[model samples]
Target chain A: MRENAKDPERHARRMAAKQKIMQSRIDHARKEQGVLLVLTGPGKGKSSSGFGMLARALGHGMKVGVVQFIKGKFSTGEEAFFRDLPGVDYHVMGEGYTWDTQDRQRDVAAAEAAWEVASRMLADDRYQLVLLDELNIALRHDYLDLDRVLDDLQARPAMQHVVATGRRAPQQLIELADTVTEMKVVKHAFKDQGVKAQKGIEL
Target chain B: MRENAKDPERHARRMAAKQKIMQSRIDHARKEQGVLLVLTGPGKGKSSSGFGMLARALGHGMKVGVVQFIKGKFSTGEEAFFRDLPGVDYHVMGEGYTWDTQDRQRDVAAAEAAWEVASRMLADDRYQLVLLDELNIALRHDYLDLDRVLDDLQARPAMQHVVATGRRAPQQLIELADTVTEMKVVKHAFKDQGVKAQKGIEL
Candidate 1:
């Protein structure tokens, strides 16, 4: 493939122009700090993406924390795999889906309890990466105080990263996040193809 | 929190109605097969989500194949962690970004070479999950035949799942996919806050 690098001069010229622009941008980006990442919307993989980060953080031997909300109805592959890992502090505090639970007071208590665990992770600098899995769901239903939640996130350790995932994230959280990704649904297997959730994929 | 389940009678009534509807939907969804998931858009986590699925599949002890395209210039945290795993076949087959490589002919050859490897995995049922990372970039640039790619995917083993990740996914690929997620960026650290990519997070 290296032999196929014909028109070397033309390629060099083009690359030089692009390199200058890219280098300037890189030069300007000098800040380094923790990031508040909000992963929200109707598509799949919001939680999956967060877990991906967890895996990466673990690869680097970083201490991590996981607090899962609104998803304790069944055992998940992620929880099963990550819970016993050496540097992980994993907690699944949800009672279940809102419709299944169907009790606002109970849901509120669960969210509050989950928040306590999450807040502890935020305050501690030892946890380099903390995944607040589906925390936005609790916030969406007003089970957790949005103001307090935002305050804790903002006041977290300077080098501590947080990833919050769920659907229909609060607008205020979006504004506060350093990186926000809204996963839009183009198609879904369960809804469009009559496919049930399967192990090692949706679970 | 269970003690906070006040208005038990009303809660039970609501739960029964919701359960009936959910059960009916579950009953109707009888198909069982692998999923074709496409993760695309400008937001982050497209590749991360694919890798997350990779971790979940590994947790279940499934044989997995990973082919990275247009991202072999520098090693990534995922490549480092997953490449040496027991049941994984990891291949980094790209010559780098198109701008850096700066040769359409060479890029086409590299993409073709990658497709050959991907097609082999698609044909084998022993590989339960295949992650074609950044394949959309090649497809988007017309380096590979879109129809041929789609045909190969459709003809893959019935129980073999595949995840394709990148930005600006073609419409035809989205239409053929069982699940498609378009990640919309509300904010980005590099763009909005001038923050450089960090280890174990964006790398």
Candidate 2:
């Protein structure tokens, strides 16, 4: 029995009011609203988590779109896993990582193309979820328009969730996000030793 | 300025939509309803992310509970930072990592105690989020009861969100999770050379 908060009856009512929440089924539960989320920080797994959410949304028979910015050349497990799914659309920016890119012009062009696809998904209400993988990196590098990205996310139709994953998400984006998750690195086996990234685990 | 599902929309409306989405919030997020989430796989940062979420909940005036299953004796930067945070109840299973804890009995006892705290949080909505840090490792090593854990999780209060983090989460837990995130390590900086886990970055 909870004795700390309100009256006993009120507490009881609060306790009993547990059946109303629907998890992972937010769109179905509300059918009136959606979320704009940012998964950022210096830690790894931001993109992985966003992609996981994308997979979950797709599994629910919902259409999903993915636009990977600042990442075009390398193949990710996510791409291999989700690209084949039905009703799923994907666009990978071919400029690759910043360190890997030789031409800034090419990188900017690739980022714009990726943003174009992501923008389309943002406006479309039919796609239940849109994953802007590494969009923050594009923004951080000044390849994409920060105000434009923010504006598009805000104007996105209801009943659709947009996930932006990358490190150093803009402060403005953080301020605008309904939910902002920062992945912090703590204990890593790689740093402990010489454990390298392996297949089926990393890319 | 709208696009059809089968047809691409005008680029400008799509851009406008992003603007709007940026301004709005993710209302009634899965967390508001208390979603059960599991962070698993070989990559690091699983427990770290869960802890970060725990901190976020605490910062928002939400009660939080943390049970570090396989993390003991190893003092982490996160523990130090959040140890003094308000509304955060922290408990670390002092059994250290599983590899170091060769004693099965001790490991089981540690896990059982951690589960005691976790299960209680699962039933109590006051603790909006309860994190079982490195729980999968304990579960994988058979230190914790899989069936009991799942049953308790299913019976948890709808307003309670339980996050289990670590490598190799049990099949049943993954199947039951409203959100299951598998952290994949792709080209980490530590592995590039022999850079050790720097304090404040990776403990």
Candidate 3:
């Protein structure tokens, strides 16, 4: 069957069968609601993809909120571009990187404060999309209670979407998320080629 | 070692040591050049991240080009948002999804035309960043010549960056890329939960 796929007639027949199944699947999916997305693992673009969704939400004229949990020491390109955009409420609440701060108490305090802002957005239906940048790091460190976080997410407005991004997402979060993508590193310029991070690329 | 992270003083000492090594690496990385990034795998966010980088490039006031390969049948939110934006030269050249078209000759022709546009952008220094969206699909289907594509990429402007996105990226492209990320699907809304594609999120 695989070898015969090159034949035009056979290919068309196979595709027709596939089209039928796909059409039925599309017809069956009638539920309309907000989705919870988790972008995690030890590769790049988790935050970038979150920001992309932020851009898409803005394109659709939807109100959105962003809360950064663990990268406040230095400003980023996304922050510079999106901070002042209309319909976007952005906040960077992290004290700094954990190693740079070197204080668990401060990190915990920062995570708590950021979660407060996130929870408010989750409660408000006006915020159609909320991006919790690096929130997984805070969860991994136990700075915030995972159960409380899960509860808040589950209890958010029915039409409000959320995107949580970071590395090493917890099992509970993955299970709860409607969509989850784990980015795996194949090669890294900085690590493999000793190239420095570029402004538009990595910053 | 991980257990002792709770001790503030010990944590500080460990961080200090790590910082020294990090600083040395930072200092050692002196060479600078444009990077080629490949985002691939069977999960979502590859094109989203490519568009995210496109946004990042635009934020910096750099000129960019985008050529979408397999997603031209229907207009996308990104295209609607980015097509008229300043400094963006966007083009969608795919005939349609392979199954939808089911014509190998037409699909190959479309791929060929898309590659022409992409190659032009690669050669032009004015396009600081060029996004070859879903080019890997063309390569995978043998609609476009991989060796020619690689040659064009290698011969691009010295300071030009390129991002190619799609699933099942060839190993040669991965080997040549400065950074490669493979998005692994832990779960999917459309697949696992039978949820339709949402406008702001999936589209």
Best by DockQ: 3
**Candidate 2 residue-wise lDDT, A1-203, digit = tens:** 11212243443344344323322222233223466667777654576566545544543456889888855332354566567658789888776665444345566688888888888889999887888888888888677778899999999996677778888888888777655666655333233222332222321
CA deviation > 4 Å runs, candidate 1: A1-16, A72-75, B1-16, B72-75
Residue A119 alpha-carbon offset, candidate 2, angstroms: 28
Instruction: Identify the leading candidate in terms of TM-score.
Output: 3
Q: Looking at candidate 2, what is the lDDT of residue B46?
A: 64
lDDT values, one for every candidate: 0.84, 0.63, 0.83
Alpha carbon deviation, residue A152, candidate 3 (Å): 1.0
Q: What is the C-alpha lDDT profile of model 1 across A116-142, one tens digit per residue?
A: 999999999999999999998888777
Task: Using TM-score, rank the candidates from best to worst.
Answer: 3, 1, 2
Clashes counted in candidate 2 amount to 18
TM-score of chain B of 2: 0.83
Worst 10 residues of 2 chain A by lDDT: A22-31
Would you give the TM-score of chain B in model 1?
A: 0.89
lDDT of 1 by residue, B1-203 (tens): 12225566676577678778887877787888899999999998998899888888887778999999876433367787788989999988768887777777777899999999999999999999999999998887777888899999999998889999999888888888899999999899878878876776862
- Which of the predicted structures, 2 or 3, would earn the higher lDDT when compared with the native? 3
The full ranking of all candidates by DockQ, starting with the best, is: 3, 1, 2
Q: Which digits, one per residue and each the tens of the lDDT, describe model 2 over residues B1-203?
A: 11221222333345456545533422212123456677776654566556545533543456778787866433354566455657878888867654344445565788898889888777787887787877877777667778899999999887676788887777888777756666655323233322333323321
**DockQ of model 2, rounded to 2 decimals:** 0.03
**Per-candidate DockQ versus the true complex?**
0.45, 0.03, 0.51
